[model samples]
Target: MGFLTKNKFTLYGVAAILLWSCLVALLRDVSELFSPIGGAAAMYTVSAVFLILVMGLPKLKGFSKRYLVIGTLLFVFYEVCLALSIGMANNRHQAMEMAVINYLWPTLTILLTIIVGRKKVSLWVYPSMFVAFLGVAWCIAGDAGISVNTLANNFADNPATYLMALAAAFIWAIYCVVTQKLSNGKNAITLFFTVTAVSLWIQFAISNEAALTFSINSSITLLLAGVVVGSGYALWNQAIIGGNLMLLGTLSYFTPVFSTVISALYLSVSLSVSFYQGVVLVTLGSLVCYFVTRDKPQKYNVKVTT
Candidate 1:
């Protein structure tokens, strides 16, 4: 019990991963009942309402409007792209494929920090990034039945799906960079409200379908998604701030693993051998990149500011 309390951050990180792992399956289910935009809009709306209840009104005094706008836009972009990537998939397996590809954001975040943020990194980190890309490629190839030609054809045919996944990665990387720079501690809830409003408006503009249908299961799933987004993020923020950053970063590599496994089990999707191989490779490569490049006693100093 003493050890558990001391290592609570580890538990928090794992709990966050579990919540996030449920996303692919839950979103896929919700997408069956609602349009992509509608699902995302509903989820964000619920999350916003939940946060409002928990955090009260945001204290926005002296907050930078520019930061608020930028943060809201970045979050909105990520949510839309993520929704489309999963919602547009033909099956849970395809959604998992998209997720594996989108999981590259963590690696991209590291590279961006070194390249654009001008942080110095070890030479070994570059090769580790390459290995992570190979893992993604392997995952894609496995999804294509281990045929290079089929892989090419798949990309050629469903370019938008793959592109959206890649875009999610890049956009998230940029968002992390921007968030690090802006680090506004007090306006997180306000920014979340802004993002939720924008997402809802976008859904209304694009989707002609009803925001929700009258189904108990769908309502439960949507509410669960909202809880995950709202509470999961709050827990993650606490972990990042209070926990050992290096250890937390290392554990984060398990997110995609958890996501893939939960998605496969919940969706009853068969996993190919190569998929397992790819997962191992990606997980290993991410750990290598993190451990090699990670500074000791790493601190985000962002303060849960959205």
Candidate 2:
């Protein structure tokens, strides 16, 4: 009991991972009920409403409208790309592929920190990132029967899907770097509300389907995704504040692995050997990057907002 109390940060970190892992599977279910845009709209709307009820109206006195608007736009971009990456996929396997590909954001964030912020990183970080991306290539190639031609064909056929996934990664990397200069705490709540409102309107304008669909599974999943996953951000923030940032960052590499496993179990999807190989290489590369950076004097401390 005493030990558990002492290591609460570890628990928070684990909870964050569990909550984040469930997001992909939950979103996949929600996507079945709504279009990609519609699903994002519903999730963010629910999340915003739930947050408002819990936190009351966000205090906006000190925050400038420009900053708030920029923050909101960033959130919108991230969510849309994220939704398209998953919702646009034809199946759970493809969704996991996009999801793992989106996981590249963390590494992108690192690189951006080095370039944009002029932060110095260890030399080994570059090779580690290379190895990690090789894992992604292996997974994708493996999915196409390890044939280069098939891999090229797959990308050519589903250019939008692959592009959206990559865009999600790039957008998130920018968001992490940009948000650091903006607000945290209550301001984050405000950003959530703004994103929710804007996304709902955009969804309505673009989607032909009616707003809101009631189903047992989808409703439950929305609750988990909107409330549970939404709240998990706070848990993650706590973990980041209390725990070793490098360790937490390293552990986050497991999110794609967990997402893949959860999706496979829940959706009864079969994972290919290449998928496993990719997961191993990606996870290994991320760990290597973290370890190499761990001893550096100036570490990239960008917060994971989603």
Q: What is the C-alpha local distance difference test score of each model?
A: 0.73, 0.73
Model 1 whole-model lDDT (C-alpha atoms):
0.73
Once model 2 is optimally superposed onto the true structure by TM-score, how far is the C-alpha of residue 229 displaced, in angstroms? 1.5
Which tens-of-lDDT digit does each residue in 24-117 have in candidate 2? 7777777777667677677777777776765567667767676677777877777777777788787777888888788787777777867886
- With candidate 1 superimposed using the best TM-score fit, by how many Å does residue 106's alpha carbon deviate from the native? 1.0
Superposed model 1: Cα runs more than 4 Å off: 1-10, 143-148, 184-190, 208-211, 298-306
Alpha-carbon deviation at 298 in model 2, angstroms: 9.8
Residue-wise C-alpha lDDT for candidate 1, range 174-214, written one tens digit per residue? 88778767755534744564576566667667767664565
Candidate 2: Cα lDDT at 8: 85
